[model samples]
Target: MLDTFQVAKARHTLGLRQAGEAFKHVISESDFNEAYNEIRTWSGYAPTPLLQLPALAQSTNVEKIFYKHEGSRFGLGSFKALGGAYAAANVIREKISTRVGHDISISKITSPEYADLAAKITLVTATDGNHGRSVAWGARRLGSPCRIYIHAEVSSSRAQAMRDLGAEVIRVMGDYDASVAATRREAQAYGWTIVSDTSWTGYIDIPRQVMAGYGVMAREICETMKTPPSHVFLQGGVGGLAAAVAAYFRQAWRDASPHVVVVEPELAPCLFESAENGKATQTKIVTETLMAGLSCGEPSQLAWHILAEEASDFLTIPESLVGPAVRLMARPLAGDTAIEAGESGIAGLAGFVTSALQAKLREKIQITEASRILLIGSEGITDPEIYTNILDEN
Candidate 1:
């Protein structure tokens, strides 16, 4: 299957793995525990599948490949289901606590008794697609109003999904960064709580909560696997998911933690650029790629702190590999079960396959026959129109 598509050597950089205070301050074990405890109580919460791809492993000439399929996560079709919703609930809980002059339990705050109090608060966020839907759904579930800001490129279907969840969907003129700016500015003016996944100066708490929520997925992976994979190729958006998973795996596995690799689209490689500069840096997204969700210009400061300490390598993949990667997951090799992955969801798989097929890159990343690989399939058929077109055209 890989023979049909040409694999290019991905541009890579070695990370400065200096695990220290910066990473520790961003997320703690207590934070992850709180998130897991709350999220597990949700109506349809269940751990997403960790699928073994023997055929893909054989095709790529690796020992094993484990892809975490997050499509069915709370039926939100992405891992964003974990972060955005949980953050929104936390925001509501804080507001209710302040109003009542007491620290309220999550169960008490989210209960029907406080529905009126929850409805009084508003949650806001910016996203290309999945995160906004998660925020909107969370708000609706918790009896709050939600306002989602999306950029011009986000599809109508995605926008409608948020609207269906009772979010006021506002489309910004520029790209994703512009949408983030809009959400921040309007949120401040309206006194709406921003449940953003990406963090900046003084805005770390909500983002920290969001990342902690993502730790639940990592915990699930850690519990199910007998031993850690040799490598984990994580999708790099603003670096929230990557950072959260990296932090959890490092803490859970300790000395035996897998070598972390952050994967991004070449057109929008904020985390990739940050690794090059040895600090969190922003990149201008001059051209958008097919992977809409990963089209981020800025690396979240909070997420970068964790990634800087944990991620051992960063890889930027070309737009060419995205369609093939998505298709490959949908129509798997002889023994592997089919996975419904979206464009951005295939970043890790694409990066891993690209690097593995290239000899120099393979040796640089230390890929061997004994190496077990972990890939995060972050989303599933996020935008049906775009997904259909990609599959149909290819």
Candidate 2:
């Protein structure tokens, strides 16, 4: 286990470096703040309600369960839009600044100007589904050319969604990690800027930007609550979202901050494995789970650093439990109060339910009656056929 002093020291160093790097690239807090404010204004939607799930709370032996539903954001049906668009905008802004020798804000860059700029640049990334769609959307919105590479396992519906958003989609003949490799190689060859969330050596800025964009969600959560959550269960992919939430919450609440639990699918528990190993590591596990979002073979370097220091615990759930949790979420929490949640969204809830280390999890952290618990419903009803099939099977 990492000592508190070490964690604090590391976080301070990382924070300073991240802030400096972000500013140098013109992707400062002001950039994220500006994008978030604009999104709030132009998007005809409010922050999704922080809903209480009494039944879920009871089942998990917690006093309360608060679900932060992201289903309603811009009707895109997922939370990917937040980070995806922010990163895309940052990339465009930087490209413009490099050519014109001055910063160009997203709002001020007209469609024709953006199109001319975008036509000169190519936005590249790999995804299971949501992230690619989000990048495609951002590229289209900025009038940039985009090329998204996805694994063969990605569903037809998701691939079509990227195409609908005007991205040139390619189906890589392997899993998620392989697609990342393929995308990276392609980006290197063609000089396209790769805005991927998963980071490796010599490639960090775009992924860090992605995480910084995700920090807006944490800020929203803090502002929405009177007394913030006592524990936050965040699902881990390449660990971008989990790291973002954990880092921001740790900064915001100091020692009184929530116990953050990073949850992963047992089949591909890359973040959990890295946390246990006390360093960033990768594995060659085949992921055959429905929670495609959590099927990452490796953790992002920036994400690993944050989780290694600050995350309270890491938990992995078996494939068997995911379906049941998805069904349970669809059922009315109390009476006539059903919450719509996708399979990926319910993974955290499943982790809480299946964990044998429940006592250890709570003991290492803190929770009480007044302590709210926040779980992100990251996606909503995206794969209705799969969701319906899971429900019917259950």
lDDT string, candidate 2, 68-160, tens digits: 887776666777777777788779778977887888777666457556876787999999888887788877777889999999788888888
lDDT tens digits by residue: candidate 1, 225-324 = 9999999999899999999999898788887989899999999999999999998899999998889999999999989998899999999988888888
Best by lDDT: 1
Poorest 10 consecutive residues by lDDT, candidate 2: 7-16
Model 1 gets an lDDT of 0.90
Candidate 2 lDDT (Cα, 0 to 1): 0.72
Query: What RMSD does model 2 have?
Result: 6.7
Any runs in candidate 1 off by more than 4 Å, and if so which? 4-6, 19-23
How many clashing residue pairs appear in each of the predictions shown? 0, 0
lDDT of 1 at 14: 92
Give the worst 10-residue stretch by lDDT in candidate 1: 1-10
Residue 89, candidate 1: alpha-carbon lDDT: 86
- TM of each candidate vs. truth: 0.98, 0.87
